[model samples]
Target: MHITVEFGGGAELLFDNKKSHDVTLPEKDKEWIIKDLLIWIKDNLLKERPELFLQDESVRPGILVLINDADWELMDTVNYVIQENDRILFISTLHGG
Candidate 1:
């Protein structure tokens, strides 16, 4: 199954490579999703920019995740059921001093 992941302040990434239909995700990745939504952020957002992983946080400062035009926060975050052709968007959250 192919899914499109959009990165906040970044570009859209496509993951067409699937090893299995019932592939269980890593425990660490699962935890990250619940706590800070890192897994979804990393999997979707960081493709060309591998340097982002080196940082302490999995989700960058400005990153905001949206699954199928709805914010992940409103949905199930990482546990959200990713269906075929589901559109995931990432955008930067505006912060003013």
Candidate 2:
């Protein structure tokens, strides 16, 4: 499946300072969910300080997750099923003033 993954508000610093990625997830026996996508991202894209992005299999506090422009919390958060061409965005709200 093809998806666009984005990071912002300082989260990009942990991903090589790049803000966007076009990812093609491998075919699998089961459908992909946000929880699974998190692992895939960590394994394939995260560059450093994973603790800043993920905590106990989910995003750390102070990060806002959006799916296709909608709040991920409205879409079931980490259990949201992924679909073709979905856009997943992670924006950090933990910035220092």
Candidate 3:
């Protein structure tokens, strides 16, 4: 499955400094969830401090996630089932301006 991942507000620093990435996860027995995707990103895409991006098995405090332009919090949050071609965005509010 293909997914679009976007980073902003300094979160890109952990992802090769790129603002967007088109990732393809191999088809498996089950659908991908936000929590599993987070682990995949941490293991594959993350290039810097893991703690800066994840905490408690989820996004760290002050980091915001949006799915298809809607806040993940309004969806199912970590349990939100990822869809093919979905657009997921992340922004770090913890960074100082």
Candidate 4:
């Protein structure tokens, strides 16, 4: 399935400073959850400093995630199942003054 991933608030820096990425997940029997997507991102898309983009299994604290422009927390957070063409955005809340 195809999905769009967006990064903002310095999150893009971890990904070649690009803000948007077009990603494809394999077609498999299991559903694709946000947690699994994170792993895929770390393995496939993350260009450098993975520690900045990942923590254990999910995004580190202070990073916000959105699904189809809605806060992912309202849609089951990391447990949310991803749909094709879904627009996912990651924004880091931490910034130096």
Candidate number with greatest lDDT: 2
lDDT of 2 at 97: 82
RMSD for each of the candidates: 7.8, 0.6, 0.8, 0.9
> Which residue pairs in model 1 clash with each other?
none
Misplaced by over 4 Å in model 1 are 8-58, 94-97
lDDT of each: 0.47, 0.96, 0.94, 0.92
Q: What is the TM-score of each candidate against the true structure?
A: 0.46, 0.98, 0.96, 0.95
Residue 43, model 4: lDDT of: 86
With candidate 4 superimposed using the best TM-score fit, by how many Å does residue 38's alpha carbon deviate from the native? Answer: 0.2
In terms of lDDT, the poorest run of 10 residues in model 2 is 48-57
Q: lDDT tens digits, residues 1-97, model 2? A: 9999999999999999999999999999999999999999999999999999999989999999999999999989999999999999999999998
Q: How far does residue 32 in candidate 3 sit from its true spot (Å)? A: 0.4
The list of candidate 2 runs beyond 4 A from truth reads: none
RMSD of 3: 0.8
TM-score of 3: 0.96
Q: Write down the TM-score for model 1.
A: 0.46
Which candidate has the highest TM-score of all? 2
**Tens digit of per-residue lDDT, candidate 3, span 73-95:** 99989999999899999999978
lDDT of 4: 0.92
Ranking by TM-score: 2, 3, 4, 1
Which regions of candidate 4 fall more than 4 Å away from where they truly are? none
